[model samples]
Target: MNSIIHILQTQGNDILNSIGQHITISLVSLLIAAVIAIPLAIVLMKHKKIAEVILQITSVLQTIPSLALLGILIPIVGIGTVPSVIALVLYAVMPIFQNTYSGLTTIDSNLEEAAEAFGLSRSKKLVKIEIPLAMPMIISGLRIAMVMIIGTATLAALIGAGGLGTYILLGIETNNNALLIIGAVFSAILALIFSALIKGISKLSLKKIGIIFMAVIVLMGGYFGYKTVEKPQVSITIAGKMGSEPEILINMYKDLIENDHPNMKVSIKPNFGGTSFLYKALKSNSIDIYPEFTGTVLESLVKTNKDASHDPKATYNLAKKLLKEQENLDYLKPMKYENGYALVVKKSFAKKYNLKTVSDLIKVENKIHAGFDPDFYQLKDGYPGISKAYNLEFASTKTMESSIRYKAIANNKVNLVDGYTTDPQIEEYDLVALKDNKEFFPPYQGAPLVSEKLITEYPELKATLNKLAGKISVEDMQKMNYQVAVKHEKASKVAHDYLVSHNLLREK
Candidate 1:
C-alpha cells in the first residue's frame, strides 16, 4: 500500500498530463463527431434509403479494430493527436448519428402538423417543435458517444498521442502492475464523470444544457487555436519499441537532448508497434528519433535473409547503409548490450533434459509445452522458423503477455518460453537460455535511429545522442530492467539515476 502511494506520488504529474490529454482528445473528438452526425441525421430524416446506406457505412467503420484503425490512419493522417482524434470521431459517430436520426424522425406527427397549422415554416417547425421534442434522445446519444470516446481514446497512446493509455502501455512494458491499475482506474473515473455530466445535462432545461455544450465547444476551439500559434524553438519526437529498455532509453534521450539543447523541446512518442511500425513511422516523418535493434533492422527493415551472419560490424554497416540510402535515417552508434530473443526454459527442465542449445529442442519436441509472446510467436525469426529449423514442435503452445512468461515457466505451466537476453526475470526465475548454435538469430545491437531532416535542423543532437553510445552494457540493461520490473521502481527514476551515476547529466 505504501509502495503504491509512493508510485502514485512520483507519477502524479504524468497521471495529470495523461488525464488532460485524455479529456481533450475525447471531448474534441466527440464535438467534431456530433457536429457531423447531427446535421447528417437531419438531412437523412427525409431520405430513408440514403440514411440506411450512410448509417451502415458508419457501422462498418465502428467495427474496425481500434488499433487497426489507428494503424491505417498513421499512414494517411500520420501519427499524434490528429490521427487519434480522427479514429475516435469515426468510432463516436455511429451512436450519435443513429440516435439523432431516430429522435428526429420518431417525433409525434401531431406536433409537426399543429406547428404547420399555426403557419410555421419547415425550419421554424424543426427548431421550435421537432428539435425540442427530440432533445432527450439527442442528449442520450451524445452521452453515449462521449462515454465511448472516453474509453476508446485510451488507444490514442499507441499512435503517439499522449493519454492515459501511455501509462497502461508503459506499465505492461515495464512490468509495473501498479501503473496499469492506476491508468485503468483513472480512465474509468473519467468515463464515469463524463457520463454523469451528460446525465445532468439531460436533466437540465434544454436552453441551459445547449448553452453549456456550446461553451465547451468554444473553449475547445480556443485551446486548439492557441496551440496553432504557439510554436517551440525546435520540436523533436523520440519514439521506441514497447519495453522497459526502449522506454528507458527514449526517456533518457529526451532528458539529455533537452539538457544539451535547452532551446529544443523534446517530446516522447513511446511504444510504436515493432520494427516495421517504427520503420514506417520514421520513413513517413511521423517520428524524429527512436531506439532500434540491428538484427531487426537487418531482417525486417533491410529485408535480409536469416542466414545472414551474426557479425555486429557487418550488421551495423548494412543497417547504416540501407537506412541512409532508403529511408534517410541515420543509425547512430550502437550500445554494448545485445537484446536478441532467447529461448529459455526452467533451470530444472534444462538440467533434466540437458538442453544446452536450441537444437536440443528436437529431443523433447513433442513433450515440450511452450509459452511465447505475440511478437515472438508470430515473427519469422521466432517460434515458427526456429521450430522448423530444428525439426522441433511443442506439444502445446499458448500465447500470452511477455511479462508473464517467466512466471509461466516457474509455475510449471510451460516447459519453454521466449525472452530477451537482457530480461531480469531469467535470473530471478532460474531459467536458462538455450544457445543458438545454428546461428539462426542475428546480432541485435541497440542504437538510436535519427532522422536526417532533424539533424539538418538540430545539428547538436548528434553529439547529444553520441554521448550515450556504447554506455549501456548487457549487464547494465539487465540490472536496470530488474530495478524497474522486479523492484518496481519507476522507469524515469531508474534512467535518471543511471545517467547521473554515469556523469551523463549535470546534478541539480
Candidate 2:
C-alpha cells in the first residue's frame, strides 16, 4: 500500500494524463456505439428476423480477438484512436442493439394498440409511446456497454492511444505489481462512474435529457476545440516496442530532442506493440522515429536472408545501406549493446542438465518444455534460428507474452524460455543464457530508425540522436533495465539520470 501511494505521489502527472485519455476513449467509443446501435435497433424492430440474424453475426464478430482485430486494422486505418475505437465499437454493438430491439418490440402490445385506436400515426406512436417506455431498457443497455468499453479501453495503450493499460503493460514487463494494480483499480472505478452516469440519465425527462445531452456535446466539442487551438510548430512522435528498455530509450530520445529544440514538441508513445506494429506506424508516417535492432531489420522487416552479416559493424553497415535503398529509412549509428535473443534456463536446470550452450539444449529438447513470445516463436532470429542451426526442437512449446515468459521460467513452469540478452530478469531470477556457439542469432545493436521525411525536415535530429552512438554498453543497458523494471524507478528519470551521469545531456 505504501509502495502504491509512493508511486502515485511521484507519478501523479503521468497517471492523470492516462486517466484523461482513458475516459475520452471509453466515453467517445460508447457514444459512437450507441449512435449506431440504437437507431439500427429501432429500424429493425419491424424486421425481427433480420434483427436476430444481425445480433448473431455481431456475437460471432465479438469472438475475434481484439489484438488480432487491431492487427488487421493497423494497415487499413492505421493505429492509435481510430483502430482502438473501431474495435471497441464492434465489441459494444451486440448488447446495445439486442436490448434496444427487445425494449421496442417487447412494449406492452396493449399500449401500442390503444395508441393506434386513439388515431396516433405509426411515427407518432413510436415517438410518444415506444421510445418513452423503452428509455429505461435502452439506458440499461448503454450501462452494460459502458462497463465493457471501460475495461477494454486499456488495450488502446498497446497501439499508442494512451490509456491505463500503459501502466498495466509496463508493470507486467518490469514485474512491478504496484503499476499493475493502479491501472486495474482505476479502470474499475471508471466503469462504476460511467454506469452511475448512465443510470442518472435514464431517470431524466425528455426535456432534461435533451438539455443534458446538449451540454455533454457542447463540453466535448469545446474540449476538442481547445485541444486543437495550440499546435506546436514541429511535433515529433517517437514510438517504442513493449519493454522497459524501449520505454527508457524513447524517453532519452524525447529529452535529447526537446532539450536541443525547445521550439519543437516531442511525443513518446512507449510500448506500442512489437516490431511489425512500430514499423507500420513509421511507414504510414504515424510516427517519426523508433529504436530498431539491426538484426530485426534483416530477419523481420526487410527479410533479406542472403548476405546478412553477423559481425556487429558489418551488420550495422549492411542494414543501414539496405534500409535507405529500399525502405527510405534512416538507420542511425548503432549503440554498443547487443540485445540479441538467447535461450535461458534456470540455474538449477542448467546445472542438473549440464546445459551451457545452444547445442546442449538438444539433449533435453524432447524432455523440457519451452515458453516463448509469439514473435520469438515465429521469427527467424528466434525459434526457427536455433531449430535449423542446432537441429533441435522442444517436445512442447507454449507461446506467451514477452514478460510472462520470464515470470514463467522463474516459477519453474517452463524449463527454458527465449530471452533477450539484456533482459534484467535473467539476472533477477538467477537464470543463465545458453551460449550461441553456432552464431545462428545475429547481433542486435540498437539505434534510432527515423523516417526519411523527418530527417529531411530536420537534419539536425541525426546529430542529436547519434550522441548515444557507440554509447550504452551491454552492462549499461542491463543496469538501466534493472533499475526501471526491478527497482520501479520512472523510465524518464532513469533515462535523464543516465544522460546526466554520462554527460550526454546538459544538466538543467
TM-score of each: 0.89, 0.86
Instruction: Report every candidate's CA lDDT.
Output: 0.84, 0.88
Cα-based lDDT at residue 232, candidate 2: 49
Model 1 segments beyond 4 Å from truth?
Answer: 1-6, 172-177, 226-233, 346-369, 374-380, 383-403, 427-438
lDDT of 1 by residue, 12-76 (tens): 87778889999999988988999999999998899999999999999999889988777777777
Candidate 2 stretches with Cα past 4 Å from truth are 1-5, 47-64, 75-78, 121-123, 231-234, 343-405, 408-417, 430-438
**What tens-digit string does per-residue lDDT give for candidate 2 at 1-508?**
8879988898899899999999998877887888899999989999989999999998998899988888788878977888999999999998899889989999988998899999999888888899889998888899999999999888898889999999887777666788899999999999999899889888888668878777887887788778778754438999999888999999999999989888879988888977878888888888899999998888778746576677889999888988988889999998889999889999998999999998998888898799989988997767987798899978999999875888898888888899888988988899888899998888899999999999999999999999999999877898899887777688999999999999989889
Error of 1 at 120 (Å): 2.4
| CA shift of 52, model 1, Å | 2.8
